[model samples]
Target: MTEKEKMLSGEYYDPGDAELVALRLKARLLTETLNQTSVSDADKRVNIVKSLFGSTGRSIHIESSFNCDYGVNIHVGENFYANFGCVILDVAEVRIGDNCLIAPQVGIYTATHPLDPIKRNSGVEYGKPVTIGHNCWIGGHATINPGVTLGNNVVVASGAVVTKSFGDNVVIGGNPARVIKEIACSDC
Candidate 1:
């Protein structure tokens, strides 16, 4: 398989591959333009985000200073909103479901390196996908790590570093986040 294909499949692949480099460059350019756009130009920002992301819902909004690697690997459902300084390293698929809100400085990462120093130093890296379910709220400065799958109506507390998956209707917090409490999902 090609490097891009391997990367998407969560296999170790050379990130310096030409195709991957070009894709990253493209994403960089697009995000730069997106960040520089005047807040008054909402239409233009929306258009740029449409062009940059692989797929997006009808009502998606992202604040300034947003960055991502391989924008095509990121997908968002309806009424998605990301606050300022949101960075997503989408080496693999990063999927966020409907009515998701991401606060400022929130980071969703899908990139990982081998534990073996030799292998890690070889410039071969892999990634695991991240899936956030519907109506999730990621608090400011929270980090969702690789391979984490959060179920619906989950609320992440500020500055939490989530390393593992959690099911629906829970509040998670702290480094290597743990479930703080189960939420009251009234609509569920």
Candidate 2:
């Protein structure tokens, strides 16, 4: 399989492969253009964002200083808004569902290295996909680790480190995020 295929399949792959390097460079350039666009130039920003992500639905708004590895591996659904300094290390797929809000400085990482020092030093890495269900809110400075999936209408408190998946309609918080409470939404 190709390096990209391996990467997408969550297998160990060389990140420094020529094709991967080129893709990252292209994404960096696109993100730079996106970050530089004036807030008043909404149309231009929207166009750039459309080109950056693998797929995006309508009414998507991302604040300045957004960065990602391999923008093509990221997908955002309709009415998605990411606040300033949102960074996604999407070595694999990072999918955000409709009507989601990502607060400032939120880090969603799908990339992970081997635990073994010898293997880690060889520069081979793997990634696990991350998914955020619809209408979820990820608070500022929250870190969503590899392979974690947030269920619909979940609220992750500020500065939380989410290490595992959680079901719908819950409020999670703290260093290693735990269910703080259950949200009783009338619509749910």
Candidate 3:
């Protein structure tokens, strides 16, 4: 299989592969153009972001300086808003559901390296998909690690490092995040 194919399949792959490199360059150029555009140019910014992602619903708004590894590996739902400095390292798929609010400096990383020193040194890496369910709010500077799936109505506090999955309607915080409280939503 091709390197991209391997990466998408959650298998080990060489990120330095020429094809992957080209794709990253393409995404970088797009993101750079997006970041450089005037903040008042809403229409232009929207057009660029639409071109970048694999799929995005209407009503999505992302602030300036947004960056991603592979735009085609990212999917976003309706009414999604990401504040400034949101970086998605989408080596694999990064999916965000509707009405999700992401604060500034949030990092969602799907890329991960092997623990084995030899393999890690060989530049072989792998990625797992990250999924955030609907109505979630991720606080500033939070880091969502590889292979995490957050269920609906979840809240992640500032500077939280989310390393595992959690089910619906829970507030999670702190390094190696743990559930702090259950959300009590009247509408839900």
Candidate 4:
């Protein structure tokens, strides 16, 4: 199977090898294009992002300091907003649903090296998809690890590290984020 195919299947793939070089080159070019100050038109900017990513919906705003490993593996829904310094290491698929608000310094990473040093040195890395449901709010400096799914309307506090799935209407915080409270409409 192709290297990309391997990655998609959640298998270990060497991104450093020649087979994935083209993808890396494309990502670099797209990153440069996105960073260019010459592109004044919003449509043009959006087009550049769309070309890099697998899919993106309308009315989405990604900040200037955004970075991703493989843009084509990332998909985003409509009305999404990513603030400054957001990084998505999408070696595999990273899907974000509609109306999501991502604060500054938030990281959604899908790539992970093996635990064993020997295996890590071999350049074989595994990846898993990350899914963020609609209308969720991810706070600043939060790290969402691989294979995690955040349910709709979930709120994550700043500096939290999400190591597990979060259910809807919940407020989560801390290093390995855990539910602080279940949000009720009456409280609002």
Q: For candidate 4, write residues 1-188 as lDDT tens digits.
A: 88778888999987876757888788878877777735357787788888888998878777777788879899999998889889999988999999899999999999998999999999899998999988889999999999999998889999999999987889999988999999885533
Q: Scored by Cα lDDT, where does model 2 land?
A: 0.97
Give the least accurate 10-residue stretch of model 2, judged by summed lDDT. 68-77
lDDT of all the models against the reference?
0.96, 0.97, 0.96, 0.88
Q: Candidate 1 — worst ten consecutive residues by lDDT sum?
A: 179-188
The candidate, 1 or 4, that scores higher on TM-score is: 1
lDDT-wise, the better of 1 and 2 is 2
Structural similarity to truth (TM-score) of each candidate: 0.99, 0.99, 0.99, 0.94
Residue pairs with backbone atoms closer than 3 Å in model 1 (clashes): none
On lDDT, the candidate that comes out on top is 2
What are the candidates' C-alpha RMSDs? 0.6, 0.5, 0.6, 1.9
* Candidate 1 residue-wise lDDT, 1-188, digit = tens: 99999999999999999999999999999999999999999989999999999999999899999999989999999999999999999999999999999999999999999999999999999999999999999999999999999999999999999999999999999998999999886678
Candidate 2 ranges with C-alpha deviation above 4 Å? none
Residue 69: error of model 3 in Å?
Answer: 0.3
